[model samples]
Target: MAFHAHPDDEALATGGTLARLAAEGHRVVIVVATDGVVRDAPGAALRARLDELRASAAVLGASRVEHLGYADSGHGAELYPDPPGRTRFVRADPREATARLAEIIRAEQASILLSYDVNGGYRHRDHLRVHEVGRLAAQQTGVRLLEATLPRELTVRAYTALEWTGLVSGHNRQALQHGFTPRAEITHRLDVRGYARQKRDALAAHGSQLRKGRVAPLVRLLIRLPAPVFGLALGREYFIEPGAARTGKPSRQIIPPAGQG
Candidate 1:
């Protein structure tokens, strides 16, 4: 099971891994914490985005997709008002969210729970909340937790270069510099170059988000890259599993052997 802060996050962070696992005949499930709606988008727009998410999940071969029934918590200094009765993911009670996720983990009998690192990738409020809730859920269900992250140094360098091009916002570049797990802390690096096409398709599915200016340019550029270039650039996904036994090389697969745990 992969738990993410928003609809597109699964695609951006772990889509390749998910697709590879699914193609290998493992049941893959995606659990998103928010509806990805901000600024009180029209009901039709919200529904359309959800539909796109479902399509993305299907293309990635996910067996199931679930939303944790929370609204998107917008970024930057000002917080957007919640849509009607819906609560922003960042404001929702952590315990409640943990319980909700734990129930799903138990039901799926999931052996692994993929979540965000301590800094929650780029430190979006919802992403940080995902880390908090995900850790609790993993503990509650006794599932092995793998925190999805990139090498902080690498991310900082990439963001710095992009920032110079005016592609990354000042706030976002700063966030990226501080987010992601340190290289020494990363325990796994899955080579997912083989699944680049699926990852691209999954990313393309989040049409609504790709239309938004804040993150659209980068997403569009990635999606438009040549398949080989995209694979070379985003082929490996980094992860950290605290207290996990590392007897051998970093795992290329998400799950460990059944008896090893």
Candidate 2:
């Protein structure tokens, strides 16, 4: 099971890895914490994003997808309050959120919980909440944990590429440089190049999310790239296991058995 902050986040962070695992016959599940509803947005938008999430999950070969019943914490210095009856994900109690996610982990008997690193891949509040909740949920359920993240240098390189296209300004680039894990901290670096098509298709399913953010252009550019180029740019996915050795090169697969995880 892969737990993320929002609908499209799974596609960006775990689409390739999930696709590869699903193709290999493992049952992959995508769990999101929020409905992607921002400030003053109509509540109906959540329904649309859920539909898109389902579409994206299908493209990645995921067997199931679910939301934890919360709304997005919009991107700004100040966080808005709950929308009607919905709780903003960032404002939701961590213990309650952890319990909710833990219930799913238990129900799924999830062997491994794929979560985000401590920095939540760019310091988004909702993403940080996801990391916090995911960690505690995994601990509560006794599931093996793998935190998804990019190497610091690769993250900077990606930001630089976006800066070149004017999608991410220097301020944004500097902020992103502080996210992701360092290379030495990485444990699993799966070569998902083979699943590029599935990954791209999954990413394309989040059209609504990809159409308006400052990083939208960067995402759109990725989707427009040729298959080979896309693979070269994002061929590998990285993760850090709680106690996995970082002695040699990172492991090629999530687990030793081809389909165990």
For lDDT, the strongest prediction is 1
**Per-residue error (Å), model 1, residue 192:** 0.3
| Candidate 2 residue-wise lDDT at 248 | 86
- lDDT of each structure? 0.87, 0.86
Lowest-sum lDDT 10-residue window in model 2? 252-261
What does candidate 2's lDDT look like per residue over 1-261, in tens digits? 999988888887888899888888788999999998786577567688899999999999899998999889977888887888889998889999999999989999989999999898888988888889988998899999999999998888877876676777888667677898888899999988888888887888888868787778778888998877898988889999877778888887886545353
Angstrom error at residue 197, model 1: 0.4
Q: Which residue runs of candidate 1 sit more than 4 Å off their true CA positions?
A: 245-249, 256-261
**Against the true structure, what is each candidate's TM-score?**
0.94, 0.95
The TM-score of predicted model 2 comes to 0.95
Best by TM-score: 2
Q: How good is model 1 by TM-score?
A: 0.94
Which segments of candidate 2 are over 4 A away from where they belong?
256-261
Kindly list the per-residue Cα lDDT of model 1 for residues 124-192, writing each as its tens digit: 899999999989998788899999999999998887788888777676666776789877778899998
